[model samples]
Target chain A: MLITKDIKLADVILQNYHLIPIISRFGIKFGFGDKSVGQICTQYHIKTNFFLEIVNAFNDKDYKPYEKLKNMSLSLTVSYLLKSHYYYNKVKLPFIENLIDSLEWEGEDNLKNKNVLKKFFRQYRKEVNEHTANEETEIYPYVLELEQNYNNTGKVSVSFLEKLKTKSIKDYADTHDELNSSLLDLKNIIIKYLYPAENKDITVQILIEIFKLEKDMTDHTELEEKVVIPVAEKIETELKKRY
Target chain B: MAVKFSFLIVEKSYIIRSGLMQIISNFYETGVVNELHNVDTLLKKLSEVNADVLIINAKLIAAVPELILDIRKRFEQLKLVVFAGTRREADEFPGFDLKISVDEPKHLIVEKIQSLINEIKPKKDNNLSENLSEREKDVVKQIALGKTNKEIGEALFISPHTVITHRKNITGKLGIKTVSGLTVYAILNNLIKIEDAV
Candidate 1:
């Protein structure tokens, strides 16, 4: 179901509790006293439409807000993405890594392969960091500048204009394919090959976390490739003519 | 990797059937042989064993001529090999994947069957639930190195269709649908190294 602005914030939570962490990304706090989504957004200073679109996209996989997202500002998109990165880096990855680190092995064979599994996950964490870091430093800043230059014409910075000469959004978009692949491989390795006997419950918990992370990453990538990149490309085309 | 195929041989003569089974079992170590004197339960046996190759006697198909067409229509993925004892019998048989004659050398029969098995490998066997079979791992390795289905098929000496079959099985077993995800599986499993990926 598409969550709208008038839906109560508590009802939205009841609809999809998974959005609790997602809402937290938007600086929304708990303890809402029977407030609608619009009311909560106003309280939190979040654009209600943007919040709704983001929430609906996460809640329902088929709810692609392509036209709606095109209407959303680039700063809002980038800001939301940055917050997601912060959550992934500071909270999620570390939690998963710690869970993986403490996993207990059963036999000689499983024990032998445990370190390789750990190393593989650690490597994935590293690769994810590299990907997000690249976007954070190189891509997102360029996008924000592209938006700024497009919106505030004749005030385009010289450095930003120079950047426009060499780089394009397609370059970044093309590199989005391998976002959560290693995480997938790690999951396969766990379920298929390197299952732990001791701390089996914790291992299952780790898998649940990994699955959630993969879904979140997939949604994030889909939003970028489908919504953010296309919108920015149009803005880029416009700004290219002026600058 | 060498192919692993379960063979379902439908031949009436006990001597010929046992002889064929012995020859196949000797050289084709991974081949599982099941013999039947009649085609009455062929379809049921095929489904039950999920056999990869079907070796039918031309005489039996000559009696029940529609059996060939029926099997073809139903199990297109099945590798059909005909055992025709004579030139006339061979002529009566359709263009199967392979035709073994009574006079052909045992080595020739083994070679032909081996090549046929190599050309097509079925995916998602029940025994493969715990792990990917060796052939699936090969496909994963090629996939991880960022090769297309055509390229992987050519490299593995299998058809693109067979490659896709393996890919589907790989996805089913590993639950990693993306090529990038399979590539990561390859890397983490040491099927391929990081430097090998493009």
Candidate 2:
């Protein structure tokens, strides 16, 4: 059963995956849709099972899935923003456009739906680009540097991400939590109208595309919380005296 | 089945140059030569793809022993044939199917493919039981465990010099040179468990 809070995220993914029938063709594709839904669910099982795994990690607690779900949604939003350019250019545009064309939506009624889809895409594109620039330019590099130091020395200097002056580690995590809330908002908006359960080629294509996007976004969030932040915190404390 | 072979040729002469081009053309005419520029590039390529056999230039065969270890880890089943210009190079590692320049006619290189094809098992057997005597295997397991030669000798009730001699023989027979390479080989061949080594 899909968790209530995850419903919107699930809807967005299920809808997008419904749009693509080509997922089967990419069975050998190294990542993304080449991966099985079962594989995806297995990877995501930990996060969904104990939502506290994410949010509570930030707060220092045990076994919390709801908090993790919320944190994941926001962390993923920021990550999506960071990688928006690559996603739009490589994945979104080619796959979505090809998907629409494959649907044969040239007729008047279908044209109307296509126009609506285009408008929805426009908002998604703009939001994603803005988010990507914010994270890539401002956030991702800091996290990457943190990861590098932690991997090498098992610590990060306190001032590692101070260039952005985001204040304390707690502040950074709180801001991360805020990002999840925003993502939840975005997900709800997406879930309002996407319907493609007919198993039509277009529906299948959309579902696959959405599934890929959602999975990428989700994994990106998990990377930050599970790996990036904890490593950053460890390094910040270790290098605190040196700086 | 068509025999797919890869070449790890290292010549100071560029592949695009006239003499090298003629050699390449001859190989292409007589056999399928998938040429790699250098040893490092060849090993990296091995990780990304699998091949039936690798025909390495004699110079490359001797130059980067570390890379040979890497290839041995990644492509354990690859049948390696070394075409070296001198007997010294051929004598350096008898474990490889080494052929000196004067002995290696173009037809000899081509004809060797049939045997190499029969040897392409894709993944080399990592079980130490397949080769090596019981005593030699015991010394190798100790070496892989980060034990000193004296410690290995003490454990096995032999002189440190005897342990060293066994190690030299192991390196010569296995064609692996580094401690890390031996570690990888031990793990793969089941000489040592991954946890024990780690």
Candidate 3:
């Protein structure tokens, strides 16, 4: 359970099945012959520091990535975040929805109950979409603008950016934890209330998918709250100082 | 109905302050314009009164970097316009929502103010369900209630494919693709009861 830079990536994923997607996200594949975490990351051209920070953050709740993220590129971190969004929206969400659709129901109100589960999943998906869309359209553009304004050597004035209605990245951060609770509600509803009669195995599979997604989303938001927001705040401060 | 606009101006110079007030008064038929000579009084007055737009002298913003930021954070809906002697001075105060040069034409200033007023006006929800047919509304209500298309079709005596088409139209009309958002919309517009949504 101890995650260190010297530990094998395979061993880490083996210990925590939830990290399988995280490992695959970096394009790391199986069949490594005793390669260490640092070695495999270097071999695959992944940012070793960023990977380690993410792994540590995932493993230990008290671990903070502030110092490591201070030196990291915001653009790179945003790209990684965008990739995670892709996994959630395109890959994991669709897989779960399809699994739910294929489940066989049993009871007098079987159809009605199944519809409730479907509706819950759909609601969670929508909330996620809205959250990610806001980040992509509003927050990302503002951060990029802040970065650009900070780096410009000339007497460039980003007065227009300042004029925008969006006050700060912190506003977006405030809405981060709302999506997690609804997801937890979905898990509870399925497990406690709606029991699929004929296809219990499929129901279990769907629950496993939900559990994996929940972990992934938790780690993703932690990185955002810990890593991305701080970096953005630093850039905003720098931009202000430059002005 | 004519939209009411309000303005708060913070400028040090008496002549320029009154002159700017005159311009705003002449531009709009009905608006409450308050002028202050100091940032301290301006901040204090803002707490007492509600204004849609805040026009501050750029010099004050430069002297106090946190002035605009503080005002913006405090008043989430207030639009900001910095009146500066030059574009360079305006550029130095980057926190203002807009910049109007002191030497700019009066008509341009009026236009800018008008635009800012329009921008700050509370957006009309435009009755998102107005375009939805009765059938579409029923489908949305069912979706919000966590009903699948198949179940909705059975309840409404329509084909599942027709239910999907209704769903598509509902999303297109409301510009909301998610069941949760549609549920909120339904509840807000009174298309579905709050108890049914849960």
Candidate 4:
């Protein structure tokens, strides 16, 4: 089912609870008695269309709105990405790490393996922190500047356009492939390699959370690669021709 | 028959690159295609993509003559294809696993790629059961009992190499990679007691 602006926010949550965290990233609070998605977005002063596209992308695996996505502004997209970084570092990573710490190992070998997993996850968290930090300090600023320049200039000179190749997003951002794979490796290690406490439910929960994070991270990267980069590249090409 | 293969194409010309992609995708039920326009990115891309077949333009190979040999050394499983527009251009890169003349009929081009895959594919057993075989179950029991590979080999009266192969097959079949994970599986399956696992 395609999520639309007029759909009741309450009903949307009832249909897919996975979108709750995604919606929260938009600075939306609960207690929506019976408001529509558009009304809630208007309350929060969020762009309702962008919010719908993001939540829809997160909710449905097959929903890729490339044409609509390319039309999104860097400021809006980057703001959403920054909030996702906050969610991961503040809410998701810490929660997973706490769950991992709470897990009880049955044997010495299992304890050793658990230590490895803990170390692996800590390192993975560090990598993600570095990646998002790089994007914030580096990629976002460059794109926002490019966008500002894109708006200002039909008078862009030939020499300035020559310098655009080095400024391409491909050089800086590899689009989170390493981060994605490391997390997948961690998930597989838990599922296939390590055996935790006999109750096993905590391990299952940990796996489920990792799986969800992986999906969310994929959507995040695809938005950058398929949408943002293309738009940025289009701007670069647009700057090449002079008025 | 449902086997899917991944491919990497290195061509500078957009027309040829897109043309090749369209052809391969049209032919296969599923295929992963990665493209690079220049040799500058080839080595980095090759390391990342892990493609089964590399259909590279002959000119790119000519410019970097030792690249094919280097790729062969690193990725022993990778099959090579010379993507030449003319037969004579392809002849310069002789002894390749396959050649794709972009002008070839669509079906013929696909057939050449499929034939290379057939030549490289490992033999499959007809009795490829989804479940672990009796021998594999016995191996899991021995693994849960904390037996080393040599110990398991001695107990099973099989060569250590054969035992290792069985262990790999067991991992593939059960999706349990570690001995401890297999121990849990063994205990759950009644192949071994919980106390034996501990």
Candidate 5:
């Protein structure tokens, strides 16, 4: 019963990725990310508020916002890495903000105080988008083949990772590292800017939101390393086999 | 209790999906049809799964002959039906055990399919030549020779597109839709010499 319940929960949890289309719409309201999100949000006619609430909740200072954001960010990172391939347009920086905007709002004032958050958003977005583009253009095709052939062969091979370790994969991983560092720098700025002594309810919410955002960034990177990379490697192996 | 038959549905368009959903809904209420999007998936499912009837989408019937051949060869007992999108397409893939167009009313498909199953019930085995005509066979042979429509047209004295038209006609008749299938047919029928193909 417990395993069944857990499996059901996993199914429900995975369904959240389906809502990326909806969450992406908030990018228009906040001008969060790049043109890619804007284009998709418009085409899909995704509702913004529902996604914004999720983003705000992830970044909320009260409750278990940090842990929640980490879980959410990992889900989102995987979803974006997977879903971006379906689109012809490349996923770029503001897309993350678009994703974040749907999950939690750190409040405008918090963003203003920790201006590094803006810089991080800007830099991280650039780096992440570039990384995503590599995956989309080169890596994703291999992954799709793996998915298509999954029924025939139940194993993932390491040759895909070996392929990734070549120049193309290293370039992507380098960009990921750069973006991750920007996020850490942004976290430091937010910590320095947080003045709990002079805070109000809005300030408290902002701090909680920032904390969640920081935790999420870290979690997102780890998941990409652990799950996404391995999946990509499996895909690479499948691709090599096909070629 | 006349025997109830199972059909596999394959298509990409929403219109086709909705129409199929409606027709199957009317007949059985429990939608047993599988809407396949690509050849690989369809082939895998067809080999692994069992069905009493095969209702192929027109687009798929036009796109993958190897898949059709494979299915027909393997599942000889299953009645093969073509749910073509247009009357022209219906005429193209000529001798399906039962042929119905997507534009046909739900009742029309239901009725035709029902009657087809009853008529061919015991001998559900599908033969590749059921749909091909003598002329269509000639066209496929010419195509396997790697003749351009113009060359084939010059030889057959038909327009290039007409050669194309005949080729399409041949594919429909043989239930072998792909160029590769036509190539294979050309080789098998000794229409094109193997050295010429090589």
Candidate 6:
């Protein structure tokens, strides 16, 4: 499918229904009327190219947005990523945790099993929190600084950023830890082993939440890995060449 | 019949080891994975079992610098992957067949391992002569290089429609449509070098 700026947001959503959640996150509503993707995104103050790149990348498995993404602002990409992190940590995680907490587990063994599930979730949440926190506190700041440095100086020395304990963008990527497997383990325990017959409804609810969070996290990481890092590396190469 | 692959993992962290095992189990329908905390047991196990792959942690490799070469000499067919926690660690072990940062998400790691397995044990029936025509192979090489269909047609003195037809035929025969997948196939079949494809 051809994805040009002239296409309406409503049309794009109609073509690829999976993009509804992603586009909706940017606060664009349905019934966009006659507004094109370019217009709506500009109205919402979203970077049109970045939005198109992301949407197209999501829609087409073969689409590689890295080259087009280099011309786009890193700050916009970083901000979008930061917002996703916020949604995951602040909104989705707590909602799931609350669901788990509200479920009734009868008898001592069931209570024990519930506690185990809770403990596993807590551990997983802690890992995710730390991971996102690291990106927010360390990686994103470093990337922003690199961008600013390059913009202000017109040329940045690798050693200058290294002095601030910020190496290349690749270094930040290297430090990333695999997000925990406890979520899967938690799902397995509940589905295959722990949940009693009567608690099927709650179990289904919890699984749905978990599945949503997993997909969000996967998409978030893919953006960072495939789009953000490559763009950053390109910037780094450009800066190095200038120096 | 599927080839049953066995993995020997040498990681210091029990959590990571178990996590890797869980991911492997989920990814592969038939495989055996044995984990060891240190280098000595890994060596002992290597002697007894013909593991298809050795996934050693970079930290352990650092502690025993000779382990990689030692294993290479003994098990010439075994694929070596250095599972690194950091890029620095990964950089240190450049000699390994692959250096995967443990930082990569689980699905990516599984995908990487699966591709590696396919590389090691390529399907006999999918050989280029039997499946892909010579013309289709040429189209695949161009596709893998990120060439547009128009560009490919220009190069081959064919119409864009002809290029698309060849692409469809190639995808049909190979059962893979993505350019990345075609690139991998091209690389595996020696149609294009890795550097050129990249």
User: Share of real contacts kept by model 3?
Assistant: 0.00
Higher-ranked by TM-score: 3 or 5: 3
- Predicted candidate 5 versus true structure: per-residue lDDT over B94-149, tens digit per residue: 54677888678766678876676566554533333444566666677777666777
In candidate 2, position B134 carries an lDDT of 82
Superposed model 2: Cα runs more than 4 Å off? A1-89, A92-94, A101-107, A144-199, B1-198
> Each candidate's DockQ score against the native complex?
0.15, 0.00, 0.02, 0.05, 0.01, 0.02
| Deviation in Å, model 1, residue A136 alpha carbon | 0.7
| Predicted candidate 5 versus true structure: per-residue lDDT over A1-243, tens digit per residue | 111111222232244443333244233233333334324344445432223334343333222223333333233434543543233124433444443333323454334323323333554555555666776666555445444544345554566445444523223453454544454444433343233323345444544544544454454454456555565555445555564
lDDT of each residue in B40-141, candidate 2, tens digit only: 567666655555456566676666777766767777666666666665657676557545353556566555654454454233323333256788889878
For candidate 5 chain B, the 10 contiguous residues with the lowest summed lDDT are B122-131
Model 3 accuracy (lDDT, Cα): 0.75
TM-score of 3: 0.53
Q: Can you write out model 2's per-residue Cα lDDT over A1-243, one digit (the tens) per residue?
A: 332333333332455443232222222133444344445435554333333242223222222344344333334333433444475556675676566545534334354444444444444455555665665775566655644554565544556546424533334552333333333332332233233323366666665666565644554466556554665566556544444
Candidate 4, residue B65: lDDT: 85
Give model 4's share of reference contacts: 0.00
Query: Tens digit of lDDT per residue, candidate 3, span A81-151?
Result: 88899899999999999988887666554665556557767878887898898889888777777666666
- Candidates 1 and 5 compared: the better one by TM-score is 1
Root-mean-square deviation of candidate 1: 16.8
Pick the lDDT winner: 1
Q: Which residue ranges in model 3 land beyond 4 Å of their true spot?
A: A152-167, B1-198
* lDDT-sorted candidate list, best first: 1, 4, 3, 6, 5, 2
The residue-level lDDT of candidate 1 at A208 comes to 96
Error of 5 at B103 (Å): 3.1
lDDT of 2: 0.51
Residue pairs whose backbone atoms clash in candidate 4: none
Model 6 iRMS (Å) reads 17.2
Residue A168 error, candidate 1, Å? 1.7
